[model samples]
Target: MATSAPLLGKAAHSKASIFYGADEYLEELKKRYAHDHEIAALKNALPGEGDPNAAGVAQSNDKMLSVQKNNENRSLKTNRLFPTPNKPDPMPQNLAFLFTKITPEQMIYMWNVLTAIFCSQVLMVIGYCAALATFPDYWWTCTLCFGVPFSYIAIQNIYIDHDVMHGATFPVYEWQRFLTHPFADFFSLPWEEFVLEHNRHHASTVDLLIQGEFGWDPEEFHYALQQWAGPWSSNWYKYLLTVPFIPVIHFFGLNDTGSLFALEWWMHFPDEGAGGKCNKEFWSKWIPRRIKHNAFVLSLWACIWLLGTYPLGRPLSEGWRFMFTVSFFARIGYSAAWMFITNFTHSF
Candidate 1:
C-alpha cells in the first residue's frame, strides 16, 4: 500500500493495485497482458526446448524474428522477377503456330529420312569411287572422280533425304522402305545418339543464327575463315581470290595447318571410334581381331614408301605410283565436291 503510488504511476492499472479513475489505463493494461500471454504460448509450442529463462527467451525470439525477415526478403525478390500468376503471360504468335504444326508422325518420318540419307551417302561414296576406278581414260575421270561423290550426295538428298526430313517418305509406301535402307547404308549410325543430338539442333534452327553447316557442323570452318575475314575483310578482290583455296583447304584438309600433323599421326593408326571417346566398347578395341587391321594397313603403307626409290625395283615403284595418283587424287576430289554440294543446299 505504501508503494502503490509509484507502481500505479508506471503501470497505471495492475490487478493487485488498480488506479480507480483511469479507465483508459485499465484497457491498455488488459491488451498488453493479452499480447504477452500469446507470445509466451507461442514460445512454449515451438519445437525446441526453448529457454524458460529471460536470456533464452530473448535468443529464441531473435531467431524467429530473423527467419521471418529472411522469408519476407525472398518473397519480395521472387515477386519482382515473376509476377503473381493472375496476369496473362505473353508469347510470340508465330512460334506458337510453328509448334502447333509439328506432330509425332511428322517427327517419325523426318527420322526415317535422315537415317536413310546418312547410310546411303556412305555407300554412295564407296560406290562412286569404285565406278571411277573402272574408267581409266575418262578425261572427266579427274572431274568425275570428284564430281561423282557430290552428285551422289545431291541425288540422295533430292530422291531420299529431303522427303525423309519432311517426314513424307514413310514405309507406308513400299518405295520408301526400299530406297532408304540397304541403298542408303542403314546401319552406319548409332541411331539413338544421333537422333537426340540432331533433334536438339533442329529445335534451335533459325536462318543464320544457329542453323548448322548443312548437316555438318559450321564450327569446322570457323578458324579457317578467320584469317581471311581478318585483315583481308576490307580488301574485296583479295577475299574473292582466296575463295578457291577455301574449299580446297576445308574439304581436303590441306590448309588444316595444325590438323595436318594430327591427320598424319591418325593415318599411322586408323580411327575405329566414329569421332567419340576411345573406350573398351568402341570398335578400336576389336581392331586387332581383324587380319587386315592396323598392322596390315601400316605394312602396306611401308611397302609404298620402300617402293618409291627411282632406280631400285621399278615395277613396284611404277605400280604404287599409279595406284596412289589415281586413288589418292580421286579421294581428294570426291571429298571436296561432296562438301561443296552440302554447303550449297544449306547456306543462305
Candidate 2:
C-alpha cells in the first residue's frame, strides 16, 4: 500500500486520473467506498478517536485516517495550486460580485463588511431571542425568530469563510485564526479543523482521496465523514449534548481522546474532544490548546452574561440559565440548519 508522492501536474491532482485507465472504475470505487462505510459500522464507531492513539499514529501517506497523523512532516505545507483567473468571466450584477477579488483593499473591505453583517445578524438573533424569552407566550415564536435569520446568515457566512479558508481573503493562513474568535466560535464550528476538512472535500470532491496530510483513504477517513455528516449519520444526542458541552467537559472529570495529528497550520478540534487530564500529555503537547479555546469561549459567555443582565435586562437572579437558554436556541438553529442542509440539500 505504499504509494508514491503525487506528481507536479493536473494529472497528479485529478482524482479521476487515479482510475482513468478503466471504464466503470469510479462506479466500482463508489461501491467499495460505500462498503467501507457499511463495514465501519456507525453503530459501534467511536466518535472522537478518528485517528490512531498517540502510540500508534500513522505517518505514511498510504493509510488514510480521518485525522491523518502526518507527524513526519508537520512543518512542511501541503497545498494544491489553484488556477489564478487571468480574465475571469464577468459576474452578473449580484451580491456575489463582491466575493470576486480585484485588489487586496477590496478583498479586506468586503470580508470586513461580511464579518460585520455576520456578527450583527448573530447578535440580533441573540438579543431578540433573549428579549422574547421574557414573554412566556412567545417561546415557540422565539424559535422561528432565531431559526430563520440565523440559518440564512450562517449559510451565507459558510460561503464567505469557505473562500477565506482557501486563502482568497488572507495571504497568510494563520491569520485566518481570528475568523473564529466570536462568529465561528458562536456557531461551534472551529475555523482550523473546518478549513482543513473542508478543503479536502473540494480537493477530491469526486472520490475524496487527496494525498499528503489529510490521509485520503476511505477506510480510515470514514469517521471524519461521519462526524461531518453530523446528526444525519452520527449519533444525534452525541451531537446535541456533547457538542455544546465541550467547554464544560474538562470541568468535570470526563474527556474524549482527540485526533493525535499535530500541525502548526491547522489549529482547532471542536469535534475531536480535546480536554481533561486523561489526555493531558497526549497529542505531542498540542491538545492542551483546546483548554485555551474553551477558556476563551467561556470568557465570551461571560461577556454574554454582562450583555444579558444589563442591556438585555435579565434579572440578576436568572444567573447563567437565561444566557444558556439563548445560546441553546442559537445552537439548535445551527444544528437544524446543518442537518437540513446535509440531509436534504443534495441528491446522493
Q: For each candidate, what is the lDDT? A: 0.35, 0.38
lDDT for 45 in candidate 2 is 23
Screening candidate 1 with a backbone cut-off below 3 angstroms (N, C-alpha, C), the clashing residue pairs are 113-164, 119-184, 120-184
Q: State in Å the error of residue 114, model 1.
A: 2.8
lDDT of 2 by residue, 278-298 (tens): 332236433444445555556
Error of 2 at 69 (Å): 16
Which candidate comes out best when scored by TM-score? 2
Name model 1 segments beyond 4 Å from true.
1-97, 122-146, 149-234, 237-245, 253-348
The TM-scores of all predictions, comma-separated, are: 0.31, 0.43
Cα RMSD for candidates in order: 30.6, 17.4
Q: Clash number for model 1?
A: 3
The alpha-carbon lDDT assigned to residue 65 of candidate 1 equals 17
What C-alpha lDDT, on a 0 to 100 scale, does residue 273 get in candidate 2? 31
Candidate 1 lDDT trough over 10 residues, lowest sum: 184-193
- For model 2, what is the alpha-carbon lDDT of residue 278? 35
